[model samples]
Each structure stands twice: as structure tokens, then as C-alpha cells.
Target: MKTNTYDLIIVGGGILGTFHAYHALKKGLSVLQLEKDNFPVGSTVRNFGQVVPSGMAGEWFDYGVRGLEIYQSIQQEMDISIRNNGSIYIASDTDEIQVIHELSAHYQTKGYDHALWSKAQILAKYPAMHADYVQEAIVFDQELSVEPETMIRQLHIFMQAKFEKYTLKYDTTVIACEDGNEQASLTTSNLEVFEGAKIIICNGYEFKILYRSLFDDSGLEISKLQMMRTKPLPQIQLPGNILTGLTIRRYESFEEYCPSFGTIPVPEHYHELRKYGIHILFKQATDGSIIVGDSHEYAAGNRLDDLGFAVDTYINDLMIAEANRIIPMRNDWITSSWSGFYAQHKDHMLEVDVSPRIHVRTGIGGKGMTASAGYAEQSIEKLF
Candidate 1:
């Protein structure tokens, strides 16, 4: 290949795109990454950054664990901050308590050491938590979190430094992609053209816009989620990522893989997809502020402005309410809140469709942070 050309051109510089670039370079492939935005402001940044392996089911669980190992290795080798603070799932109801017990038993059988914590034990370990409503809980010691935006920025800088020959073009949008006999050509909005032997689309929700033909029948849609961060609270101390029993009831790992938790009724609006429960994951930053979130709303297009302030207030109030139940803290200031979009697939499995010289990785759903590295590696291996 010529110096200006590349062996692979990756569109969308999110975690998935960056990981694809990283691994492709490791395989000795000249790579070029393009992003429309200057900074990663999508789901990659607007998340709790929790890598919960125990929450993943079946093959995805293995992938999550392997990805964590890779993340740790990379953190050590590359000087990044990955906090393995662990995670705790609090059960506030009788059914939720039963689910925690059953999930603990199931994870133990699967070689995972998720421990069941009695209400007293939990309250003792984290005295800030309100144990009155929590009947039981589950703790996963291997779970971890990171500052998502910082990690992406550092990774982008590191990739550019380590792979000087690899190209990263920001403020550049891939307008069209065409496949020829031996290579794929991409035309950017700036009218610049780049050619590569292979192309991988990791554009998240925008994947449908770029490759409409492939996604039209694949059951892929966009999910917009809301998240918020509270102002600094000196007294608050979260021991780990916090999850509610509702999460276990919704995630497949709690149901099919473990077969411990009984089904909680899916919300009426989300009945078709069988999605219920709110995930109130809390993690404190270095600045003594807590970031909590998220509720899902799916649509066919990018819809950020449609988020009602009332909805934001409602969710934030709910998050703080849940946090106070788990930790004894009072939040006075609401620092900031925002929303972002991610891919939602019907099967809950990421799919990589390959043409002769082109590949597309979509359907990451909400697990992009946890599964991107492993998924990207597998996609590259299948492509080249």
C-alpha cells in the first residue's frame, strides 16, 4: 500500500473504532480512523464506565472477563487509570432478595465468586447505606470503572504517539463508501478520498445511516439515554458501583445464564423488547462528585432535544433517592446532565456483517464499553 493509503479505514472514533484501530495496528495493518466530532461525545462518554462482567450472560460474560484482562494489561503497559472498585447490587424487595440469592448460587456454579451479602453485612461494610429496605445484595469483586472521556482522550493521544504512521482525522465525516475490486474507497464531507483494503463501520447509532441496506433487516435501532452528575458532596463515599435488583431481572445473565431470578414484568412501554428496571450505577470521581444515571428511550433517529427537563429532573430525583438508600449522603447541587445514543439490536448480540472487502460492527447496545475491545478483535480477525 502507498503511504497515503491504508490497509484498514475505520469510521467513527468511539471505543469500538479506536479498539479496532489499536488491534489492527498490532496486526501490522496500516490504519486510518475518521470521526465527525472533535471529541467523543456519544455513548462512549455519557456512561457510568462500569465494566460489569457478572452482569453479562453466556458468551458475552466470557468476553467481558477477557476484555477486562486486556484493559488491565493495557492500563499497566500504557499508563492509564482503570479503577477496579468492584460493584454491589442491592435488593430492596422480597423478590429482589430472592433473585440475589439465586444469582449468587448461579454465578458460583459458573466459576464466578459473586458473594451474597446479608442486609446487616452490607450496612456494616458501607455504613453510609440505608439497610432498612435492602434485604440482600450481591457483590462482584472483579467489576471495574474508568473515567470514560479521559480514557478515550488518553487512548487517542497514545494511539497517535505509538502508531505515528497511523492516521486519525477528526472533523471529518465519511459521506459515502464504495467497494471496488481490491479496495474500499471512502469519500469524506471535505471531498477528500481515502482508499483501504478493508473498511469497518463502528459508528454506533449512526451505523444505520451509513449502511442502511445492511441494518434495515437486522433489527437495529437507536436508544437515547439520560444521565446526570451531582455536585461535590464531601460526606459521600461509594465503595463500589451500585446496582439495583431491577437490573438483575432485566439483564439476561440474571435470567437465562444463571437461571436464578424469576422474570420481573417488563414495563408496559417496553413490553415488546422485554426491558424493565432502572440501572442506578454510582461512581465518585476524583473531585468528590457522584455520577449517576440512566434510563433508556428508543427511537428511529437522533433525538436529543426532545428530552424534557421534567424527565431529567424526575430521573435525577430518582437517582438521588436510590443513592441515599444505598449511601448516607445529601446532594445539594446538580452539576450537569446530558443524553446520548447507542445501538440497540433485537437479539442483544453484536453482529459483524462482512462483504468481500467491507465489514460492519453494530448492535453493541449498552455494553459498548465492556464488550468493544473483544468484539473489535473478533471482527478484525474475521475481516482480515
Candidate 2:
């Protein structure tokens, strides 16, 4: 390759793209990463920052396990601020408890370590929890959490400072991609051309811009969510990544559990919450602030404006109320709230070969944070 030519050209600057860059650099491959905006403002930063392999299954679960290892290695090598907070999923109903029982058995077969706690044990361990609804819990001691608000930015800074093979281009949009017999050339918004042996597009949910036909035909849909964060509560200490019964419905790991464990009989009044794909999960940020969310709605397109960025106050309030029901808070004072968007497909992730040398990966849904890095590494190895 020429001096100016890169070994790999990675499109997008989100976790998927950056993790690809990280792995490529690990293999001593020169990389050029492009981002349309000055920084990442998508689902990469607007999430609970919970990296829980316990929430995934099969290969995805393995990906999450590898991702946690990567997070740990990066944090130890530098200061990426990864916290080993672990995760606790509470079962509020009999159906949810059944899922826990089945999942626990499944975990044992898979060599995943976790503790199944009775309500009494849970109360003894965390007396602050509201015991009225929670009957049992599963504690995943290996789960990890990071500060989503700052993790990506700090990782980029670390890469720039620590690696000489990496280059990041902000405010740069890829306008065209042409693959040759042995290499690919990409034209940016500035009309500048760059060449690489392989071109990997990790644009996240912004699919239409680069490859509209492939994106449209890939069966990808948009998922919009509402999330909120509270001001730093110096007096409060959240146990870990707190998950409620609704999570069993949203997360894929509990799918088998659902069929065997049976469906949860949600209250008649709370039917609207279920209709909107709402779930309650909480995590404490490094600043001592609490992060709570979220509800899901599918969109026809991948753009945020078409789906709208407005946070539904009704849904937001319902989520906050549910969180309060689980753990009594000192105050319900929230400092920030917003809507987040990501890509999803009914079956598998939206990954396809746009050309012989050009590849696109997105639509991993909410599992982006948990498994993007590990999956990206695997994908790149297969590609090269």
C-alpha cells in the first residue's frame, strides 16, 4: 500500500467503527476513520452504558463476553473509565421468576456465573429496594458499565495519543465508494479520494446516505427510545445495572425463558406501557447521577427527524414512576432527558456486502454497546 493509502478505511465514528479501528490497529493495520459530525451523538453516547453479556445469548452472548474483556483491557491500558458495577435483574412476578429459573439453568450449562437470590436474600443484601413487587433476582457479577457520555470521546483521544497507525476525520462524509480488483477508493464530501485494501462501513443507523438500495432492502427498521438522567445524588448508591421484568421481554437472552417460563400477566392499567415496548433499567454514572430508561418504537426509515426527537412525557413519566416503584429515591429530580434512536431488524443484524470489497454493518439494535466491539473484530477478521 502507498504511504497515503490505508490498510482499512472505516466509515462512521461510532462504537462500531471505532472498535473496528481498535482491532485493525491491534493487527498493525493503518486505518482512516470518517464521521459526518464533529463527534458521535447517536445511540453510542445516548445509552445506559451497561455492557451485560448476561442479557445476550449464543454467539451474541460470546461477543458481549469478548466486548467486556476489550473494555477491561482498554480501561487498564488507559483510563476509559469502565466500572465493574455488575448487573441485577429482579423478577417482580411469578412468570418473571420462572424465566430466571430457566435462564439460571441455561447459564450453568454455558459456564456463565451468576447468583439466583431469593426475595429475602435480595432484601438482606439491598435493604433499599422496594420488596412489594420483586420476588427474586439474578446477580451477574461480570457485567460492566461505562460513562457513555464520555467513553467514546476519551477512547478517540486515547487512540490518537497512543497509536500512530490511526487517523480520524471529523465532519467528513463519504460520498462515493468504488471497489477495484485488489483495493477500494472512497470519495468524501470534499471530493478528496482515499484508497484502502478494504472499506468497512459502520455508519450505525444512518444507512440511506451511503447505500440506499441495500439499506432499504435489508429489512432494517428504526427503534426510538426515551431516556432520562438525574442530577448527582451524593447520598444515594445504586447497586448495579438494575433490570426489571419488562427487560425479559425486550432482551433476547430471555426468549427461550419466555416460552418455557410463560408470559408475564401485566396489569390492565399498564397495558399501554407494554404496547409501547417500555422497559425499566437503571445505571449510575461516574458522576453519581442515575440513568433510567427506556421505551421502544419502530420507524419506517433510519433518520431521526422523520421519527422525531421529542421525548414522550407520558412515557417518560411512566418510566420514572416505575423506577421509583422499584427503588425509593431521595427525590425525583431529573436534570436531563432525551430520545435515542438505533437500527434493528426482525431477524439478524443488518450486515451485508455492498460490493466485493465494501461492507456495511448496522442494525444490531440495542445490543450495539454490548457486542459491537467483539462482533466488529470478528467481522473484520473474516473480511480481510
Candidate 3:
């Protein structure tokens, strides 16, 4: 392989890296993006494909809205697949219903139209739901979903077309980054070295390995979430994003900015069994198949074992039970399941640090997809 130099070098090919690359190229900076895998085999592709903004903190609400607008405009201006399928956070219990009411009030104050639904209205819209299980709902008509894998693939294509000078090297991993005061040199796994005036590390979970010294005291921890995709049920009609009261409690805005009802304790019987930190978010893909899941388990590395299977099964069972309450249909055909890891810090906001020529962006928490474009733009403004 030949060694080359560029104005900017991005360390990861995931959504964040690609997004930053796209923005950087638009600034007319010669850019190169390196990825260890040929395709995005990370959490970027494994997630629910949900570009959710409804539950984000107030500080990041604008970023979410901006990113949502970017996705909505991608098809018209650029090349990408984004579906504004609209999402709803359904409340089943009285406490959850109260949370929805509070969220509606906060969103209205923020000029967002989060529609508050009465039980009668919800029943009229979704008659499949068990009357007893649904009390109210908050519908975010602007929330959307996309096939993440497809989006990434299309982004690369679009980048190639728009920025003919941009370079993308797949199956090339950055083994080491030497950050000097003026510039950085990136040595790849194949012994290929590239130097850039500026380098942005967007390696997601692999950040600790590349910059362990910088983050030694940052208190960054990796969160592993298990998720599963169910077999397509021809009869099931998932109208929107489905969530319960637990989601409202976990999301800070709903608790602090919105001041929702007090947290409800999980039943003692299900606490240990379910490991239910928050409620499940169920959304259907363009295909009839429904993607259900999600249980948070934090660890140092992306590791899995037989014990995780039990927990995954428990989570799937819980989601099925909740889905049945809303849409009673027992099609227990599970197609496949997998787990992914995301970076989380004490503060949910992403951090961007720039020192002359070197730039760093990370700590997106789980909202990377939701605010990547806006965050990348912010980074660009600060760096340039």
C-alpha cells in the first residue's frame, strides 16, 4: 500500500465518522475515512434505525431537530433513505399517563407539537390495544426511522459522487494515533501510515483503546444493550414508535425539564428477572418484521455468554407481553438476535475538544444517530 497525506483523517467509518467526513468534505478539506470492517458491523447498523428526538434532553433538542431536518432533506438534496414513520410513546398506567401529560406540556412550551392523546382518542386510533393496558399517549409526528445499514451504504455512495477527491479505505484499522502539538500521524493495522493536519477519533466503543491516556480520568463507561428482531407477522400492524412509562423516567428531560410523575418501582418479582432498567421501544421496519428488544448491561468490553441469552429471552418475553397488551397477537417466531455497545458518560452531551490541529468527538451516549449531523456541524464550526 502507498502512504499518503491528507488535510483530515477520520478514524471510524461508523455513522459519526461518516457524518463528520461528509461535513468536512463540504468544507473543501481533503479527507480520508478508514474502517476496520468492510461494512459498518457496529452498533450503527445494529440499532433500531430510530432517529428519535422526542425523549432527548432540552439542551440537545435543537440538535435532534436539526439532525431530523437533515435526514428529511437527504432524499431531496442528497442520497439517503429516511422514513418519517412518526413515533408514539404510549402510556399504559396512570403514572405513565401523567408523564405523557407532562411531556406534552414541556414540548408545547418548546414549540414542538407533541400531541397528547386521551384514552378515547388512543382507542379510536389503535383499537388493537387492550383497553385496560392503554391510558394515554404522546405522539411525536416528526420522529422518524431509517435502515441504518442502508443509510451508511448510501452515504458512502453519495460522498463518492459529490466529493470525487475524498478517499475511503475500508478493512483498514487505525492501530495507533500519535497526536503531536501541530499534527497527527495514524498508523494502520497493515503498517500503512497517514498524516493529517487534523484527526477526529470517532471509533465509538474502541475509543478507549486508541486514546486510553486522554480518557483515563474521564469516567467513560461502555454500555452493552441486547436487542432482538422478531419474525415478520403479516397481521401485525405497528403504527408508530411504542414506549412505556419507564422510558419517560429514564430520559432526563421528561423527569427534570418536564417533571413527570414520580418513578414507579418495578415489581419485585420482575426486577431481578427482567433487568428492566427502562421500558422497551418497539418499532416496525419497512418490512413487515417488527424489531423489539433492549436491555442495558454495561461492561468493559463487548462480550457475551449463555447468561446473556437468558436475559435476552426475558427481555423479548417482556416486550411481547407489552405488545400483546397493545396488540394481542402471539407470533413467537424470532428471526435473529444480537447485542451492541455504546459509549456513555456522566453527562449525556457529547464532548468536542480541539487543540490547534487535533480534534476529538465522543460521548454521544445512545443518541449518536439522533444528533450526529448537528454535533458534527458544531465540531466543524469549532475546529474551523
Candidate 4:
């Protein structure tokens, strides 16, 4: 028989929503996750799938640590296409080295296991990196890298087989939600109604759709990025997640080390790249293909066409040119390029309780993959 009612109703099937389901199942609650499309095709799959807690700050860093634990636990239980590969931040100049030293102090204070590799040590292990450009490197051994395209699908499959009470319905659009003391009613696009004790909305970028009034009133902005993946290159052997000087300014964790960490000036030739918030990060996938990216563009009030959503060749060219300078990769090696959009706010996340029984959570920004598992567990605990 079809389940007419569930213990919890989760909207959206992205990583955030799926993690919420995982936690709810741990609570022994029957879950029904609704996805508008066949599967999640959002920032969750578009990202680099890098879970580097070293790039986050404050509570977010803690959440990242817990998420890392969750990912590792799942890996022990199943074949989730996970990689325990670590991350390395290559400092090219003295200024970048200063940022690394400051960040190292904070990591040590927090008891995060890390090591500062000298130029000689870095070259000895990864000789492919330019010798003159590398001054030092910070090695984070606990970080993880996952296959973005398969992780979610594999997770969903695992949930279906593991939890008999869990149900995932795709191509099901939740049109309206009515909250009450006893139970919450969700009306789908087909006018089919289902009941659940609680409703949680996790539709990431679709903030304005289900709750238009609240989203309009809230100060949520749209952030778009342009990224590319290269064809499999058998010659290159990347040591781990490769981060450059631009990333030092981009991630908040570095700034926690030094408030003025992001104040370094951009070189004149890279003015156009800086205009779009371009950063060069390279990661070798399991298939030996490298994932290269990305430039940030902020759209106010979800402006879809004002450069943020569009994939401009000029901006992509600048990113390719910059990546080439960093690692000397062939421009023609780029096999595919695309754009991704996500909801962002100045705050850590946008969590709103529409009613006593209805809650909406999103605006996780770029830390979705890194912090979702831990954050969702805490959210579910508080909700119950």
C-alpha cells in the first residue's frame, strides 16, 4: 500500500535535503523526500565535491568536521565512491606564505592535524608544480573528495535499501503546505495530498518558489559560478586538491587567521579575472580527468540574465589562461564547461520557521557539500 502519511516530509532532493533524510531516518522517523525533477541537478552536483574543513571558519568549520566523520562512516558501510584524498594549498609568494603561517596557528590552537611543507618538501612530493612559484604548502590530511555526479544517486540508493520507512518521490512538485497542530498537509502538482507530522523545505536555489513572500522579504542573493572539466589526461599526476593564492582570499578560514588576509592586491594583468572573482583550483578525478574552475558572480534579487547566469567565453577564457599560468595545462584539454547557481546570504544560512510545523532551510552558500551532513543532523535534533 502507498504511504499516505509520513513522520516527516522533506522537500527538494539535493545533498541538503538528502542529508536531512539521513538524520531523520536515524531518528527512526518515516521520511518522504519529494524532488521536482528526476534527480537533483543543482550546485550539489556542479561543485568540486571537496570537503575541506580548512577552508571554513567558526561554527562552519566544526560542522565540516562532523560532516567529514559522517562521510567516512558511510564509506565504511558502502561503496559511495569516496576518496580520503587530502588537500594542499600551495603558496606562491611571501604574502601567501604569511597567510599559511597565520592559518597554521589557528589550526594548531584548534588541534587540527596539519603540516607545513617547505618548498623542498613540496617539490620532492609533487614535482609537477612550478618550482619558482611555490614557496610553501599547507597539508590537510583529513579532508575528502567525492565523485559529485554519483554520490547523491548512490546515497539515495543506499537509503532506499536500508530504510524501509523511507520514500523518495521524484517528478513530484509540492505546491502548497498547510500546517496544523496534529499534522501538516502537502498538496502536490497533481492535487494529491499527503500528511506528515513536520515539513522541511530544502529546495536550494528555488527559494522564491514555495515561499514567495518570505523569500522576497528576506535578504537572499543568487551566486553563480562558471566551471570546467578537462578530458582525461594520463600524463598529469596531481598530488591532491591544488589551491592557489587566489583561494587564500576566497575562503573564510584563512581570514579567520588574519582579518586582513583577503586584502592582498590582485596583479594588473589579472584584473578581468578578479572582476569575476576567478580562482584557480585543480583536482584530479578518479578517471584521471581534472576539474578546473571557477569565477563568482553575485546576482541581486535573483537576476537570472545579468551576467551571473550566462556562460561567457571571455570569462571562461580568462579562467583557462589563469589556470594555465598556475599549472601550465593545455587550453584545448578542457572537455566541458558550464555554469552553476546557488542561493547565498551574508549570514551562514537562511533558516526560517514558516509555522510551528513548517521549516525552510537553505542559503548554505558554497559550503553545502562540506557542512550539510552535520548541519542537518543538528537541525533535525533541534526540530524534534
Best lDDT among the predictions, by candidate number: 4
lDDT (Cα) of model 3: 0.73
lDDT of each: 0.74, 0.84, 0.73, 0.86
Candidate 3 residue spans exceeding 4 A from truth: 180-182, 263-274, 300-311, 329-331, 349-355
Q: What is candidate 2's lDDT per residue for 1-384, written digit by digit as tens? A: 222489999999999989989999988999999998889999899899999989987799999999999999888878887988789999888778888888998899888999999999888866767889779999998899888989999999999987899999899988989998888999988888899988889887886578777776778889899998889876667857888878865677888534664455666656878888889988888778888888988876545467777888888888877787887653357888998888887888877887888888877888988999899899888887
Greater lDDT among 2 and 3 belongs to 2
Tell me the alpha-carbon RMSD of every candidate: 3.5, 2.2, 2.8, 1.7
Clashes of 4: 0
lDDT of 4 by residue, 1-384 (tens): 133889999999999999999999988999999998888899899988888889999999999999999999998888787788788998877778888888998899999999999999988877777787778989998888988888998999989998998999999998899897799989988878889999999988885468887887667788889989999887777856788877876788997776558676656766777798898888888898989998888876456456445588888889888777667677689899899988877876889998988999988989998999989999999998
Better of 1 and 2 by TM-score: 2
Number of clashing residue pairs, candidate 2? 0
TM-score of each: 0.89, 0.95, 0.90, 0.96
What residue runs in model 4 are displaced by over 4 Å at the alpha carbon? 1-3, 259-263, 305-309
lDDT of 3 by residue, 89-169 (tens): 777676676777877877778898778888898788766667887788888888878776578878788888889769998
TM-score of 2: 0.95
Error of 2 at 174 (Å): 1.3
lDDT of 1 by residue, 1-384 (tens): 222478999998899899999889989889999988987778788888888877877677877887788788778767655888888888877767777777777777888877888889877776666767567889998887888768887788888888866899888888888888878888888778899988888887764347666665667667767677878766767756777655756666777754445555434433422341356667777677778766777654334234332455565566566556656535476678777677777776545556676777766888878878877787678777
Candidates ranked by TM-score, best first? 4, 2, 3, 1
For residue 72, what is the lDDT in candidate 2?
A: 92
State which candidate has the highest TM-score: 4
Question: Whose TM-score is higher: candidate 1's or candidate 4's?
Answer: 4
